[model samples]
Target: MITMVRNVSRWFKVNRFMGKCTVIGVLLAFVAVACLGQLASVQLLNGKSTAQAATASRTKTVTISAKRGKILDTNGAVLAQSVERYNVVADPELAQTFVPTDCKEKTAGNCQQIDGQPVGTTGAAAVARLLAPILGMDAKELGALLSGTGQYVVLKKEVTPEVMRSIDDLGLNGCVYGELSSERLYSNGTLMGALLGGVNDEGAGVAGIEQMQNAVLTGTDGYKKYERGGEGVEIPGTVTESKDAVDGSDVELTIDANVDWYVKKVLSDAKEQYKADWAIAVVQDVQNGQILALEDTDQYEAGSDDAKLNTSRAVSQTFEPGSIGKVFSMAGMLQSGAHQLTDQFTVPGTITKNGQTFKDATQHGDEHWTLAGILEQSSNVGMVMAGENFSNEQRYEFLSKFGIGQDGLGLPGESDGVLTSAASWDGRTQNTVLFGQGYATNALQVTNAIATIANKGVKQQQSIIKSVTDANGHTEDAKTGEPTRVIDEQVASQMMNAMESSAEHYSKFAGVDGYRVAAKSGTAEVAGSDGRLTSIISDWSGIIPADNPRFVVTVVMKDPQGSYGGLTSGPVFKQISEFLMQKYEVPASTPRTDAIAVTW
Candidate 1:
């Protein structure tokens, strides 16, 4: 019995071992077959596709746009500012499940129709309905827009934060919101429109002072990307990418909003009163050669679309300034040692030169007048005689110093009022230019000429921006100085004296009061195609508070109802001078020096 039991045990053990071996072999065979299949698939079907897919994933990159800089006035007032906006998006593929409607469903499957879009569906229609009202768009249109096969598509851009929140609560399937940035408001609207300009849809300034100083205004951008789990929870400190954005430098303008407002108001009112074709007004800080206010009323309104036109007539347009321009001729004579304020001109009220008659403002003609009296009366003949005394080269040099035909200034668009070469000044031309008959100049160039005298004969380049603000609320790059010299101090002094005298006399005549003023008015007939004066167009310009001048104001009246500077523009000038005097607390000009002596 013991021998039989041993034999059975041995057989049983052998059987068990064979069964285990069979199972192990079968497992090995299956693993080998699977390995072979995987290798073949990689070589024949997956290698190139995998490589191409990876390349495609890395090929196209996405970039977030940076926000532009802000523009401010001298007082740290926001002239141009940037605000955050949003773009709404939808995933049509996922949005098909929600129904678009006002009713809420008890379960995800039961979606309602909102504005005709199925909202409860996890499809594009629901996303469109939930977002359409918040975005102020037609849901039907939005759905159509989302019907695009793209994995992601934008529905609307520049959406405010409020709208973004409303969309987020809807929880529409596949709907996402994106963020964009742009400037929101202008402080004064169109007060300094021409100077501040505007940024593009991408927030880049394309014109005006903004474009001119982009380098200083544009800032850098920064970004952060972190690894997030499926539920939007951050994997602690798992920062994927990070970059910082630099905020743009703040730009401060020299323009004073109050002054600009008044200037524009006065000019615009004058435009209506004179029934003029156009009008321009300007005010400057004589101390630093900074332009306080520069405006043209006939061209634009504070919020009108037409105001955005590119023409900077204030710094671009120049014409014969008529009598107002007589001051420059007077300047030339004084600078050239050719004439004096005391020098007398023959009594003829008119000068017949080159078969053209130049008439003085007064028809009841004074018999003879001093150089000062000639300017006071705006005598064409007087200027002609004085201009003759100046050699052509001498005349050109004097005007040249005033920036006529010069290629420089504070703001852009400096028109070198046409200065005929000495050779080009024919005898007729010589007399014609004396009373501002032939030459043309921009308002800024003319303003600068007066500014030179105001700056004590030194013309500084005018700049609209005065300073920039840093991140820490500290100011930087402040333009805190005066312009370079363009004229002799004494010459400027004499010019100021003459202009003040004229202003005082005119103010007296016009019955305007409360300020010591000096001014000159011009009513030059705009040139016609026939090379003769046209009755249609007229202009006026002058300096104010003549002694120790605080402001240089220029008024241009085009095609006035009266068509004369003294009649149409003189009143406006006086009103503006008096208004500015009170507004700026400018002390009345009490000349400390006796009038400048003219040398022969």
Candidate 2:
């Protein structure tokens, strides 16, 4: 019976083995047919698709961003710079393609589980949702990104470690970190915000010197080419080409940090102390027209609704300079060659021209004031009496010559200022303008006017840049705007003498202090709705260590806690000039041993 059972078992096993062989035969035949069909399609029917796929396999490329250039103050202190950052990337396609080995606990089919929750916040719909919060993104947005069909996708371009940790919790698949270029911080926050400007993510300059010299500041990008495998990792021995990045040039500015800081500090304080709406300050070298320090912090801060820095006023604000305009008025008259400093005028405490009533700040009845005294006390009437020398046409010409209508500062949104043609002038315009009331001017114009005076009647259009260096460190003197001399040297010296006299009295320089301090102070009632003076704006301009004058500085305080220009703007000027004197070790221009020459 056992023999019979064994025979039956063997027979059954043979039958089962035969059945398996038959099934294997059929499958092999079908696979052979499919392989032949694919071969035929590639060899003859439509080989273009195969060729394109192969070519694509050979063209993988990578990018390396160049580092950003440096920004330094005139003294070479770093202001803004660049550093390396990272971008996170993921291969969702690879996550789908991977397969696990027998020993591997994480397998291709269930790799999504290893990927944890997707980056998106939408619980089930997203691959990136899990990473959204850590990366500072909306789950819905990340989900949409992951659900897309791209072979490669940027998960996050800029991220912190705090963000990376959150992504790790997600257990995402095919996640990778890549390097990117970014801006480094400035130790000095907002110190020269307007001047230095900031960079965009793509490293493009938006304003100021940064924008002006972008080509030199931006470095060349590098490239890498390699054959990518099916999983998108580089194939071994497949790198064909690479080009290293060229670093950008380091830039240096002529701006002095200390000087800029001082200017900002004093002007910011004055603006607050005076409750003034705006303030502007400038310090420039007389030997060459390099602006050392320039600030317009108050108006912008007030507009910002905080003490924080914002809105640049230096190159922006334009208003009627009021009596402060007298500094130029005196210069223009002197430049016209018809005026002298000793010229005496019997200012009857007022002067009437074209039915306009012009009076001094306080009435000093019918007293003789020299051209020097008129400017010293900032007398509006006294200037009108002395202004008889230059014709209206000559006055306008002189104003234009000194860069009133065309300083060519070339600042964005720069104004031509308000100088209507004198030919269209009314009695009110002429008289009010005579004492610096009718015309409007910009901060640049005011500084440029005094700059012209400091430059000995030469209108050296003000510039802040010293030189622009190329990527190779070759520097070309910045494209300099031409200087137009508005007055003869002799006349300029005379007018400077008058200014010196005025400065001495206002500053209480008891005797001829060795320093040739040439200065002028102005206070004009800010004309309200009636087109007449009622309130006030105070301003001051001067040059110090007068002989071989080194610095020409202009400080203006608007609607200060006090009323007069001398009181509101004077102290700021003193502090600034004193600092500069000590910094530069400026000695007084030898005390005047004899009579000094001046023009009205």
Candidate 3:
């Protein structure tokens, strides 16, 4: 019995020990299963989100600026262009977290001992000290910039690519970077400054041709997005997204840079020689109305504040056309069958009719004059007498057809010169209109008006831009409508003959030796700075090689010492006409056998 009881006790003790082992095994199994679930949750269910979070901490995005297009002259000379440059930028937050490695033996990394001296500091201070010399910035100021909480700051702008490379070699990890940028460069300085216009701080066109062609001149910006390492440097092969920038299309103007340069010089010299307040000149191709050169005395440097403030005066300012109006009126008289170029008149120095008195520029006795002589002498009284048969509606019809008071060239700040309807004309204004005193017009209008006769009574739309070429090499010519007929072809020839005799009047001072110029001169009294008629606008318009017209040149001067247009602006007309003939190798005029009888 005792042996059996002992056996039972032993068995029960063994079973209890086995039960404790089983319980511990079950607990261990439960813990392993729990760990497995947690591992699955972390490695599978939330893995993508976790990885994205880690990347978010180091990812960086940078803007890549597109290069702006160029403005080219007719000869493909660069007028305005963009030069590649860089803006040195910094992640101030990253710079503030930077810690340099200790220099025990010297390694290929930034070290605490910069320039062989223990940098006595950490974080932003150490970075600024190393970068100060390279960037030519004060260490203290640089440190202040790097210590800011902002993610990005521009340390310097418009640095050359060479300088940008030097900064990159310093390797402040990802704390410093270079952002692609550009600087606008005007190669010709103030040559066509106000006309070429300028860009703003953000590289947008604000005036002149730059503003007019902003859509073609401005390029779309791009971006670069990538992941960076803890050192703030882009990891190898980590560029996640990027787009190459599309450069802007190039604009080619009709202006010949050489011609424009010469014209500007001539005008500048004339402006000083005459002691004029300002001067403007325009040269147009009679066939196409392409403006070869447009210049003014108040030129400003491109990309300058003056360029922003001032506009091209050639299309902006207006003045009474004076005797230049005689040509239009004479054309009207001939076109309307009111008078013949040979019709005789005894023009007195002054005349009074309808309670209005009119006089010539110089006091003179009665002179025998024909219609052609009246124009050559720019006789206001003769015009009044010749226009006696011209009705008011016919007077307005001719002026309107000649493009007076019309929108010009579409340049910025261009004005449609003032011209009241003929029905509104008073007695004096009626006579004044016949000789070019009661209305106003700009230089371009005067140029085109003469060009109308040169082009056989057809009017061509004026164009400054010649063509546009895109990045892929496609080109589009400038758009212009068909020419409009303003006068009969035969009438234009008759007027040209009459003008040939008129130009002879300026032979002493304004004649081009080889070219037969059909020209007219005008002098008008305008309001001065004091609002009185103390200022004089002297203007001359000439069609060169009158027998076979090629170019029309118009010159205008304000407050000139030489008060007469024939004296002040006429010489300028000669110089420009000679240049055009020589440059284009135009043949000399055939003898003027078709000259109209100036005196019958």
- TM-score of every candidate: 0.81, 0.81, 0.91
lDDT for each residue of candidate 1 in 365-413, tens digit (9 for 90 to 100)? 5466678777776778778777767877776676777777665444445
Query: How many clashing pairs does model 3 include?
Result: 1
Clashes by residue pair, model 3: 174-232
Which scores better on lDDT, 1 or 3? 3
- Cα lDDT, all candidates: 0.67, 0.68, 0.89
| Candidate maximizing TM-score | 3
lDDT of 2 by residue, 1-600 (tens): 999999999999999999999999999999999999989988778788788789676567888878777877788787677756567676655534333222135553433332443222222244444455567778667656555575567877766555555555444433333456464556565565665555555677655556666777888999988886554656778778899988787777768989988888888787887788777887888867778887876332111122122335676665666666676777777666666677766678877776777788897787767777778777888878877776778667666666665644564445677777889878677767767766667666777777777777787757766665656678766667677777778777877777777777666521223456777777776665577776577777788866778887877766787777777777788878888888888765776654443322
- How far off is residue 446 in model 3, in Å? 0.6
Which ranges in model 1 have alpha carbons more than 4 Å from their true place? 1-32, 35-65, 91-120, 226-238, 298-308, 352-357, 364-366, 407-414, 470-474, 478-487, 508-512, 528-532, 535-542, 589-600
| lDDT per residue as tens, model 3, 1-600 | 999999999999999999999999999999999999988998999999988999887788878888889999999999999998988888888888877776676664645556776677778898898788878999999999889888888888888999988777766777888888999999998898899989999999998998989999898888889998876778989899998788899999999999989899999999999999999999999999999999998869988989877888887899998999899989999889999898999999999978988889999999999899999888989999998899999999999889999986888888899889988999888888888889999999999999999999998998999999987889999897678998899989988888888789988989999778998999999999899999999999999989888999999999899899999999999888888899999998888776777776
Index of the highest-lDDT prediction: 3
Q: After superposition, how far is residue 258 of candidate 1 from its true place, in Å?
A: 1.2
The residue ranges of model 3 lying beyond 4 angstroms of the native Cα positions read 1-45, 100-105, 108-120
Global CA lDDT of candidate 3, please?
0.89
